[model samples]
Target: MPEPHQLAADADRAAVVTRLDESLADGRLTLAEYEDRSTRAHGARTYGELAELTTDLPRPAAPATPAAPGPSPVARAVYGGAWHGAWGNDLRAAWTSWLVTGVIVTGIWLVSMLGSGDLVYPWPVWVVGPWGVVLLARTLGERRSRGDRQLPA
Candidate 1:
């Protein structure tokens, strides 16, 4: 732990100010006292100086732990996969765009082939294959991060 005699950073001063503001909001300090404490907090050079501003106020409560999340029903209905939530929505959009682009490029390739009367290289594969692979990798990575072994029904 840093000693109170240590120099205070801007963040330290800001924290003290926040405490003072809370104290004022809760009627622990009058407006004049809050202003005085706030000015002193901002001007404080050492941690001890900042600490003196909030010595009487209680500590802020610790944040409660979040509950385990279930799959989002709307996302599930629209996306049709085990994936749900923000990451899942993003992946679904990416995959949808990739699929649409693949279809368009493949159609263009088919038209060119008909006009030339020769089956040349499918250049669209070069465009879409690597993109699809990257998206697949991202999807798998998201699943791994969530500790999911199999896709949901």
Candidate 2:
């Protein structure tokens, strides 16, 4: 498990982002305003502050998809929970699917770049998304192999 500080930070980020989403949906904030706020929200320092910001915000739709397999740590971490409730497993499956997809996407991007074409993704997306996939793949695999001992059967 990661340090509590990091988990708290991730939760804070998720909350702040949700607040940004609510602000964008309401006419009280414009796209540009939302963008500016989003930039700041991503840099938020504490869950307390994020809780404050989202106090008046409408509830956001959960990113969890319970019909699937367990959620990867990235899913849990990004979605502001230890596990994504019933959908955690499904989200983990989705992450695995994305990992395979990311490899294909990167391969195509590489081929395109080699042929004097452009990558479908920005350089950072290729780097970050795949790294996340790989990390989550390992994390979820470890969790799954540990069996229902840790998670609900």
lDDT of each: 0.81, 0.61
Q: Over 4 Å off in model 2, which ranges?
A: 1-7, 25-28, 61-153
TM-score list, all predictions: 0.55, 0.29
Q: What residue runs in model 1 are displaced by over 4 Å at the alpha carbon?
A: 63-70, 75-81, 84-98, 117-153
Residue 137 miss distance in model 1 (angstroms): 15
Model 2 residue-pair collision total: 9
Cα lDDT for residue 79, candidate 1 = 41
Shift of residue 140 alpha carbon in model 2, Å: 44
Q: Per-residue alpha-carbon lDDT of model 1 for 43-134, expressed as tens digits?
A: 99998888788888898999999875655677656644445434436676788999999999999999999999998799999999999999
Q: All predictions: root-mean-square deviation over Cα? A: 6.2, 19.7
Clashing pairs in 2: 66-87, 68-90, 69-89, 69-90, 70-88, 70-89, 70-90, 71-88, 71-89
Please report, as a residue range, the 10-residue window in candidate 1 with the lowest summed lDDT: 79-88
lDDT of 2 by residue, 1-153 (tens): 333344346766775777677677777678987786677677767555455555666666679766745545664558433334343344445566677877777776788787876545446476557678666766665556555555323
Error of 2 at 26 (Å): 5.3
